[model samples]
Target: MIIKIAEIEEEVVFSGIICADRFKSDYENVDFFGPVEYSLKIGRSDKRLSVKGHVQCSLNLLCARCLESFRYEIDSDIDLQLLPREMAPTDIDLELERDELDVRYYDQDEIDLTELIEEEVILNIPMRAICKEDCKGLCEKCGGNKNLNECKCESGRDTRMAQLLRSYLEEEGDGHGGSQEKAIKVKKG
Candidate 1:
């Protein structure tokens, strides 16, 4: 991901990088691994500097249903101006803003873009991972892994009436099944 200063002449550079999922920060939510690609273009024109490029890559994720790994690829683009590190225009008695496309410095002259790519990829990851688009998740009873085994753990309540009653109350408040008002009605009726 390092580009030498002398190479910016209207030519594009293509390269590959190993995107460690951990580097994505948020990527640790789901275990994953894989490769990333980047294409960069850099050049300068008087007081104006240009940094235009894009990145593309894929990542492996664990399927929530089967708990297996799968690949998900995505792409991103970048077009930006190169600004001065932290010097002021007034200090130089110049008309430009204190933080403009730097008549003085450039990014490649200092900062590296490795961190930028890692950030974009993590943001692009899918919120949910399914081995197959329509995978049947695990069975909640008998501790069975639905993708691998079958169990007689009644797909129904399979619990004592008292336990089911407690669970019903808990789930009702969870805002998924029905509201707490419905739970009170059920208890009374």
Candidate 2:
């Protein structure tokens, strides 16, 4: 939804649902399970705008570890200072001050809230989604889901460390090391 700057004289409260079609193309991989619900209070002072409210939605996403489909919920608070794009400095490597962290740039006399709502949902999604805290993940050998059942795959311990330890023990022969001599003898015999 696009809100025109001219429409807001002082402050306006808007509560509505944004359909999924508005941002379906924005994220190809994301599948929104429902429409985005928003309750925003937009205030205008000169050309500057302040949008404060909350947005929430549910999404169907794949778990990073188990690769299973899971429902991810997003409930984000919106407290943004909207400024005209022309007001932004042209410096490419400029660092933003502490107060400018929540500032967002807008183009023309309208604010495209569709983009803002989509951004809030995307930012809340976890980088690595886990279905549960104790998810066993998939087995390496037979490619089976370990959460369902245990696999009969043999234990595959790396032998390089064992070989290195054996050589180190052989070099320390009979020199204040009884355990090392026993280990060397066990390996050699």
Q: What is the lDDT of residue 182 in candidate 1?
A: 29
* Candidate 2 ranges beyond 4 A from true positions: 25-29, 90-95, 98-100, 154-189
Candidate 2 lDDT score relative to the true structure: 0.70
Q: What lDDT score belongs to each candidate, Candidate 1 first?
A: 0.53, 0.70
Q: How well is each residue in 109-189 modelled by candidate 1, as lDDT tens digits?
A: 543557656655555555554555344456665556666666767546556985578556544433532221121111100
Best by TM-score: 2
- How displaced is residue 86 in candidate 1, in Å? 5.2
Model 2, span 1-189: residue lDDT tens: 788998889899888898877666766456778798998898999888889999987766665556776776767788988888888766654526514668888888898877787787667655555556456567667888878887777355537886577546544532442332221111100
* Per-prediction TM-score: 0.49, 0.71
Name the regions of candidate 1 deviating beyond 4 angstroms.
1-7, 10-14, 18-34, 43-53, 79-82, 85-108, 147-189
